[model samples]
Target chain A: MKLKVYTDRMSQPSRAVIIFCKVNGIQFDEILISLAKRQQLAPEFKDINPLGKVPAIVDGRLKLFESHAILIYLSSAFPSVADHWYPNDLSKRAKIHSVLDWHHTNLRPGAAGYVLNSVLAPSLGLPLDPQAASKADKLLTKSLSTLETFWLKGNAKFLLGSNQPSIADLSLVCELTQLQLLDEKDRVRLLSPHKKVEQWIENTRKATMPHFDEVHEILFKAKQRFEKQREMGTVPKPGFQSKM
Target chain B: MKLKVYTDRMSQPSRAVIIFCKVNGIQFDEILISLAKRQQLAPEFKDINPLGKVPAIVDGRLKLFESHAILIYLSSAFPSVADHWYPNDLSKRAKIHSVLDWHHTNLRPGAAGYVLNSVLAPSLGLPLDPQAASKADKLLTKSLSTLETFWLKGNAKFLLGSNQPSIADLSLVCELTQLQLLDEKDRVRLLSPHKKVEQWIENTRKATMPHFDEVHEILFKAKQRFEKQREMGTVPKPGFQSKM
Candidate 1:
C-alpha cells in the first residue's frame, strides 16, 4: 500500500502533482496512464476516479483526484514543508488559494482549451477554426493580464508573495510549459509579452523543476502525434464559427 | 484588530462567508456593503478587494477575497475545526474540494447568473431576455444532472461521505439558495426534480438556516422589485444571447 500517483507526464495537472511530490519529499510509486492511447478510459483507473481524469492518487487507503485538491491534501499531511509551499499565515495562504481557484475556472480552461483547439489541433492537420481559437486566445490574454496586475506584479520570484516557490508557481509553470506544445507563436506570446511572467517561469524551472526538459519533450512529442492523427483524419476539427 | 467581513447580505458569495462563519462558530464583525447602491465600488472598499467583490474579510491586518478562499483560510487558521468541516481525510476532503471547485465554475455562474438577470432584475423593473433565460436554464439543468449522478446520489444528508455538514454542503447550499430567487415554477423545477438533492437542501436548511420563511420572503421581494424596474423601463432586457 505505497503512495501511488496515476499520471501522464505531459499533462499540466500531472506535472504539478509530480512536482509537489518531488518538492515535499513524498516518496511513492508512479502509475503512468497515457491519455493519447486512451488508457485513462480503462476500467481499472475508472474505479479510482469515476470521471476518468488523470493525476489521481492512491495513498494507502486514500484515493484522490484533482491536482489542487491533491496539493492541499499533501500539504496538510506533510506540514514540515507546508510553511513555504502552502503557508500557515492565513492571508498568504488565502492569496494562493484564491489564485488557484481562479486559475482553474479562468486561466486553465482558457489557456489549455484555446491552445489545444486552435494552434495544436490545426497543427495536427485537423481543421483549424480561427474564430474559436481567437476567442480562446482573448480569454487567455485577459487571464494573463489579470494575473499580472492583481497577483504577480510585485512578487519577487513566485506568483504568491514568496521568495521561494509555492504550489501556485508549480501549477502555473506546468500549465505554461504545456502551452509551449501549442505553437511556437503562442509560446513566444506567453513568454515575451509578459516579461515578468517569463522571468518568473524561468525562476520556477530552476528552483523546482530543473529536469523540465524531459517533460517539455514529452509534450512536444504529443503535439506531433496529434498532428499525425489529424493528417490521418482520425479526429474531426472543432466546429467554430463566428456568431456575430 | 478583530476579524471583519465586508459583505452584502443579498449577495451569494457574502452569504457563503456568513454561513461558513455561522457553521464553524467563527465569530466576526460584519461590515455591510450595499451592492445595489454600488457601495462596494467605493475607493476605500476597493482598497480591501480590488475586484470589488463582497464577502471580503479582514482578520487583523490581513485582507482576503473570494468566498472559497476565505473558507480555506478559516480552516487553516482554526485547525481544531478543520476535521469537522474541511476534513483532513485525504480522499474525502478531495471529493469535497472538487465539488466546491466545480460549483464555482458551473453552478454559481449559470444558476445564480440566471437568477440575477432574469428574475431579480425583472423584479426591479429591468428587462429580462427570454433567450438568456433559456441558456441559463439549460446550463443549470446540466449542472444539476452532474450533481445528481456525481455528487449527491448516496449522501443522504451531507455532500461528501460525512453524516454531518461540511464546507462542501455550505458552498453548495449557498448556491442552491440563489435558485429560490427564481419564479415559483422555476424553483420547483430546480428543487423537486432531484430527490436526493432536494432532501439534502431541506436538511441543510433545517440544520443551518431554520427560518427559511424570512430569507425566502426577502428574495421574493427582491424579485418583485426587479420586475417593477423592468416594467418601469429602468434597464434594458439582456441584449446578448447567452452562449452557455
Candidate 2:
C-alpha cells in the first residue's frame, strides 16, 4: 500500500506536507480533513491523530503526525529524496532541527495567530479580538525581524543559509502565505517592512515552483470568497455561529 | 574544549538537557542563566540564542538552541551514548520524532501552562488567572488521557515501547515534573486520576536514575521555598513585580 497523508490545504502544515511529497515525488494518497468544515474533529480522523490536527501520515507500519517529524521521516524513509531537503550532515541536520523546534513557539504561532485574528476569524463569523490581533501582529513582526537578522543573515535564499529549500523553509513559507488571505492594507502593514522576508518568500516559492502554487489553491479560493463577501456587503456578524 | 551548556534548572527544558548530559556522560560546561534574574535577557546570552531561551549549547563550531534539537544534536554528536536513546532504525527514530513533535503542541504547553498559571504565577506574586488555569488543567488532563490510552499501551516501560528511556521521555517527564511546585491539593487534583501517567513518570525517573533526582534539585528547592512562605503566613502580594 502507498503511504497515506491526511491533510487540508487551509492548514499551513498540511500544505507543507503536500508540497514536500509532491516536490520529492514521494508516492502517497492525500486525504482531506477540512478544518473549516470541522472534519478534523471527527472520530475517524481522531484515530489517526488523537490531537485531531493535520499533516499526519501512515507509511508502511509507521504512523506519524507533526509536519516536521513527517518531513524528517519521509526524507529518511525514502532515500531517493534529495539530501538537501533534510541533510545527513550532523550539524546541518541539527540546524534544521533547531529551526523547526524554534518554529512552533516562534514563527508558527506568530504568523498563524496574526492571520487567524486579522482574516480567518472575521470570515469565519467569529468576533475579531482587536487586542489579540494586535498582540499577534507584534509577535509576527518580531519573528520576521529575527528571520531577517539571524536566519537570513548571509546572501542565502533559504533559512540556515541552505542553497536549497529545506522542510523548515517549506513549513515557514507556507505559514507566511496565509497573509494572502488578509486585505491589501492589513497584509502590507504586516509584511511590507521586511524586504528580506519578501525576497525569501519569493525564493522559497521559486524553489518549490508549480507544486507550491498547486497546494496553496485553497487559500487563494478563500481569499476570493472573502473578497466577494466584502463586495456583496455580506459581512458576518460577531458571534455568528458556524464551525471554523 | 568541552560542550558548553547555558541553562537555569528552574526552566524545565534546561533541567532535561542537564539530566541528558549527566545520564549519557556527555561532558559540558554549565552556565547558569537565571530566568528569575532576567539573565536570559542579557546581551551576551542573546548572542548565543537571539530568542533568549534557556537550554542552548555550544559544541565545537555548532551553536544550537531548543532542548529537543539540542538533545538530537548531543545524541548524534556523541556516538558512544546508548543507541536506544535515539535509535538508528528508521521507524523507531520516526516514532521518537513523532512523540517529540506531538509533545510541543500537546503535553508541553498543557503541563507548563498548568504549572505557570496555577503554581508559578501565584508563587511569583502574580495574579493567578483562574480561567486560564482551568483551561490549562483541562488540556493537561486530556493530554494525560491520550498518553495513557494510546502512547503508553502494552507493557512498555517508556514511550514508543522502548525499554530504555528515549530523549522524548526525558523531555516530557521533565515538563511534568514542574507539577511539583504546585500545592499538594492542586498537584494531587491534577495528577492523581492518571494512574498510568504516574507510573510512566516513575518509570522515566527510574530509567534516568540518580541524574534525574540530581538535576531536579532546584524544583524541589522552589517547592520548599513556597512551603516556607506559606508557613510564615507571609504570602507575596498580587501585582508584586519581580523578574521571572
Candidate 3:
C-alpha cells in the first residue's frame, strides 16, 4: 500500500511535507484536510491523529504526526533519497536535529505568529490584536537577526551552512513564505533588514523550484483574495483559524 | 578534552542531560550556569552558544544547544551506551522523535508553564498571575489526559512501549517533576487523576536510578525551602526565573 499524507497547503509544515515528498519522488496519496474549513478537527482526521492536527501520515501500521517526525521517518524509510537531506554523519545529523528542534520554539513562532496576527487574523474576521501582532513582530525580527548572524552566517547557502538544502531550510523558508499574505509594504518592512535571510530564501526557492511554486499556489491564491478584499474595504469570511 | 556540559539542575532539560550523561557514563565536565544570576546572558557563555540556553554541550568542535539535540548527539556519539535509550529501528526512532517534537508545543508549555506560574513566580518575587496560572493548569490537565490516553495506553514500562526507558520518558518525567515545587495539596490534586503517568514516572525514575536522584537534589531542596518559608510566614528571596 502507498503512503497516505493528510495535508493542507495553507499550513507551513504541510507545504514543507508535500514539497519534501514531491522532491524525493515518494509515492503517496495526498489527502487534503482543509484548514480553511477546519477539517482537521473532524472525527475522521482525529482518528488518524488524535492531536487533530494536519501534516500527518499513515504508512502500513505506523501512523505519525508532527511534520519533523514524519520527515525523519521518510528519510529513513526510503533510502533512495540523497543523504544530504538527512545526513549520515553523527554530528551533521545532530546539527540538523538541533536546527529542527530550535525551529519549533524560535523561527516557527515568530514567522507563523506574525503572519497569523498581522494578516491571517484580520483576513479571517478575527479581532486584530495589535499587542499580539507587535509582540510577534518583535520575535520575528529577533529570529531573522539570529538567522543571519548565527545559522546562515557562514558561506554556505543553507541553514546548517551546507551546500545543499536540508529539511530545516524547507521548514523555515516555508514559514517565511507566509509573509506574502501581508501587503508589500508590511512584508518588506518586516523582512528587508535581513539581506542574508532574503538571499537564503531565494536560494531555497531555487533548489526546490517548480515543486515549491506548485505547493505554494494555495497561499498565492489566498494572498490575492486577501488583497482584493482589503482594496474593497470589506472583510473576507473567516477561513479556518490555523493553530500554527 | 572531555565534553563540556553547561547545566543547572533547576532547569528540567539541564537535569535530563546531566542524568543521561551520568547514567551512560559519558565522560563530561559539568559547568554550572546559574539561571538565577542571569549567567546565560553572559558574553562568555554567549560565545559558546549564541542562544545562551542551558543544557548546551561543547564537544571538541561541535557546540550544540537544545537538550533533545544533545541527547541525540550523545546517543550516537557514544557507541558503548545501550541502544534502547535511542533505538536504531526506523519506526521506533521516529516514534521517539514524534514525542520529542510534540513535546515542545504540547507537554513542555503545560508542564513548564504551570510550575513557573503557580510556584516559581511567587518564589522568585514575581507577582503571581492567577489568570495565567489557571490557563496553564487547564493546558496541563489536557496534556496529562493525552499522555494517559494516547502515549501510555499500552501495558509498557515506558513511552514507545519499550521494556527499557527512552529519552522521551526521561524528558517528560523530568518536566512533570517540576510539580514537586507546588504545595502538597495542589500537587496531589493535579497528579492523582493520572495513575498511568505516575507509574511511568516511577518506571523512568527506577530505570535512571541514583543519577536521577543526584541531579534532582536541587529541586528537592527548593521544595523544602518553599514549604519552610510558608510555615514561618516568611517570603523567600527570589531566585532565578528560567524562560523555559
Candidate 4:
C-alpha cells in the first residue's frame, strides 16, 4: 500500500509536509486539492477527511489528518531519517512540541488570516477590512515577539540547539516563508524588531533552497493568483469564503 | 526522580495530566499556580516556562510543557498503563493524535474562550463584550459539531473505542467537565443542538465520576467568582482581559 498525500501548494501545512517528505527522501503520491476550485469540499475528498481539510494522508490501511500527526507518523515509520527530523532527546522533543502548539494558535492563525484576508478572501469577492489587516499585523508581530523571546533569545541558531534542524524548523520555516509571500505590503510586517527571527529565516531559506525549488515555484504561482485576483476585481469567490 | 506538576485544578489540561498520573499510579508533587494571583507571570515561574502556560511538568533533569507532549512522555515512561491510556496500535495512536490536534484548535480554544469571556473575564473586573460572547458561541457550536463528526461519530462511549478509555477521552472529557461548572450558558449549549456530544459528555462523566467530582469542586468555586464579579458590575477582569 503506497502512502498518498492530499494537499494544495497554496496551503502552508501542505507545503511543510511536502518539504518534510522531500528532505527525508520518502516516496509518496501527491493528490493536489485546489483551494480555488473548492476541491477539498468534494464528496470524494470528504470521505478521506470528514473535516474537509487538506494535508491528509492514507498509508495503506492507516489514514491520518493534521500535519503534525503526519509528521510524527513519517518520523516513526522511517526511523533512519527520524533523528535528523524529530530527534529522540526528551528535551528537544519538548521544545519541538511547544513551538508546534504555539504555531497552531499564534503564527499559523495570523499568517493564514493575513493570506486569506489579503489574497483568498479578495479572490472570493469578499470585502477586505483594513481593521482586520491591522489586527493580523498585530497578531503576526506578537507571535514574532514571542518566538524572539522564547526560542531565539540566546545565540542558538536553530529553535532547539546549536546546529541541528528539527521538524520544528521545517514546519515553522514553511509557514513564515508563506507569510513573506502575502503581497509586498503585507510581507513588510516580517521585518519587525525580530533580528534573530530574520536571521533564522535567512538560514532556513538557504537550507531549503536545494530541495524546495518546486515548492517555491508553487508559492510563486499562489502569489501571482493573489495579484491577478486583486486586479480582476474578483474579490471573494462564491461558496469559498464563509460569510459567518 | 519524582515528577513535579505545576497546575491549577480549574485548568482543563492541568486536570487531564493530573488524572493521567492518578490513573497510572505515578507519584508526582503538585505546585498549584494561581491564575488569579497572576503567579504564572512571576519571574520565578518564567524561568521554567517563558510562555507561562500550564500543565508543565519536571521529571528528573527533563522539563516538559504542552499537555500532549507531557502525556506522550508519561506514556513512554510508564509502559504498563500505556496500552490502556494511549494505545500501542499505530492506527489507533494516529487517531488519538489527530483528535488531540483537533482538540487544541477546536474544542479547547472555543471552550476556553467561552469561559474566559463569559466567566473569567468578568471575574477580573474587565468589561464584557457581547461580540466575544457571540463569537465564542459560534466557535463552540462548530467545534462540538466537528468533535461529534470526527471523534465521537461511531464510538459514542469513549473517544478512542469501546471497552476502555484512552488519553483522548481523558483530555476531551476534562474540557467538557471543566466547562460544565464554569458557565451555565455553555452547559446549555453543549446539551442543545449537539445531542451526540451531550451523550458522549454524560458517558464520560459517568465513567469518571470520582475524578469529575474532584475537578468539578474547583470549577464550581470559579463559577462563584464570576458571579461575585458580575454583582460588582464588571464583566471582564480588568488586568487579565486583553487590552486590545
How high is each candidate's TM-score? 0.84, 0.92, 0.93, 0.89
Residue B64 of model 3: what lDDT? 92
Which candidate, 3 or 4, would have the higher lDDT against the true structure? 3
Candidate 2 positional error at A114, Å: 2.4
Ranking by lDDT: 3, 2, 4, 1
Q: List per-candidate RMSD values in Å.
A: 4.6, 4.2, 4.2, 5.0
lDDT of 4 by residue, B139-211 (tens): 8779887776667768547774555677778888788765654445446645577777787777766666676
Please identify which of the two predictions, 2 or 4, would achieve the higher lDDT against the true structure: 2
List lDDT for all candidates, in order: 0.73, 0.84, 0.86, 0.74
Fnat: each model in turn: 0.58, 0.78, 0.89, 0.51
Better of 1 and 4 by TM-score: 4
Which portions of model 2 miss their true places by more than 4 Å? A122-127, A235-244, B122-127, B233-244
lDDT of 1 at A92: 78
Candidate 4: deviation at residue A158, Å?
Answer: 1.6
Candidate 2: lDDT over CA atoms? 0.84
DockQ list for all candidates: 0.53, 0.74, 0.83, 0.55
Ranking of all candidate structures by their TM-score, best first: 3, 2, 4, 1
- The sequence of per-residue lDDT tens digits that candidate 1 reaches over residues B28-141 is 888988878888899999889887778899888778888888887888686455476776666676778777767866787778767766666644456766665776777888
Provide the interface RMSD of candidate 1 in angstroms, 1 decimal place: 2.0
